[model samples]
Target: MSEENKTYTQEQVDKLVQSETDKIRTEYTKQIKELQEKLPPEKDEKEVDLANRLKALEEREKMMDVQDELSKKGFDRELADFIKSGSDIEKLTEILKNNQNYIPDKHKGTETTITKEQFKAMGYSERAKIYNENPELYKKLSQ
Candidate 1:
């Protein structure tokens, strides 16, 4: 039939329009997909920022936990940063126990009192030893 003479029913006209629309839609979809593949994947700024914040918060929590554990174990909480044992409290405790000797003891014994006359009688080496041990006491005695 001649195209000009051809008459399409409503159903036929609807089908033709639908088929063309589908083809155009498919072609545009394919083009969009291809362009997307060629371009770098976009990073969601808010998601990345949230992930970083979460990581920081997790680290802070872990550090605080370690400090609390240190305090409970009678170790200096300041040692939390120096602890190599990640989350293993047992290993941390063992390490602290083994190296307990290295940690300074804050408890001081009664200070030995010496009269100025006794200080004067001390040799240079003795005075030097006392000075090295307690400079304040040495200064007091020396004066």
Candidate 2:
């Protein structure tokens, strides 16, 4: 057996993890401070987290990513058009109702797509359908 592949003791792993964490903490503190300062005063941490959440989702795509699935599910043009075309939150929520499963792993566990149970949780009832069985195009966005 290779010496490197041999199981390391738990104590050894803990030391390595602690060292890497300390390194990361020193490197990230500056950026965290800057982000905290730049955020608007009226915005709460949860709101900022939401914005960051969407930004992160928009930043990275899985192999069969959110956009790809959404396009395949025929939800992209409408969703993009909704967000870009200045649709209201209610309108956007309605659009999200389509393919509740159209949501990607990256956005799973988020309230991005609203369902009947979700609507009930929020005291909402119905939403407009916006699913296309098959979209003519499946384009990936640039990071």
Candidate 3:
């Protein structure tokens, strides 16, 4: 005896494909749910997003506060960002305290000039010599 092979109609083939697709989808969904259950409870998406935003805002606020405090203490604008990033307020304060109103030793005695009253008391030759040496100073004092 010989057996004959049977061919499936297009509609039957489509139904069979649809059933397999549905079965695979159901299995995948079940596996995904099981994996999710194995993990710890998660925060809501909105809550997680808001928390991250809040943290960033707090950091920005802290940076601004540091900048303000440094500026008020007369630190140079060029070094503000470096000091703010480093976040060492005490070091900044120490630098400001040590360097405030600093004048180098070389600049100490270079401002000598005779006033009009002092020049008037000097001898005629001395006045002429002083005027010749620094005419600009003499002119300023004479006024």
TM-score, per-candidate, Cα-based: 0.39, 0.22, 0.44
List the candidate 2 regions with Cα displacement exceeding 4 Å: 1-4, 37-143
lDDT of 1 by residue, 15-133 (tens): 99999999999999999999999998786999889989999999899899888887887778898878745456668778768997774557756567788999999999999999999
* Pairs of residues clashing in candidate 1: none
Rank list by lDDT: 1, 3, 2
Q: Which candidate would rank higher by TM-score, 1 or 2?
A: 1
**Predictions in order: lDDT:** 0.86, 0.55, 0.79
lDDT of 2 by residue, 50-71 (tens): 9999887765533224445446
Off by over 4 Å in 3: 1-4, 9-15, 28-87, 105-112, 115-135, 141-143
Question: How many Å off is the CA of 112 in candidate 1?
Answer: 21
- Determine the backbone clash count of candidate 1: 0
Worst 10 contiguous positions by lDDT, candidate 3: 77-86
Clashing pairs counted in every model: 0, 0, 0
Evaluated against the true structure, the overall lDDT of model 1 is 0.86
Q: Candidate 1: minimum summed lDDT over ten consecutive residues — where?
A: 103-112
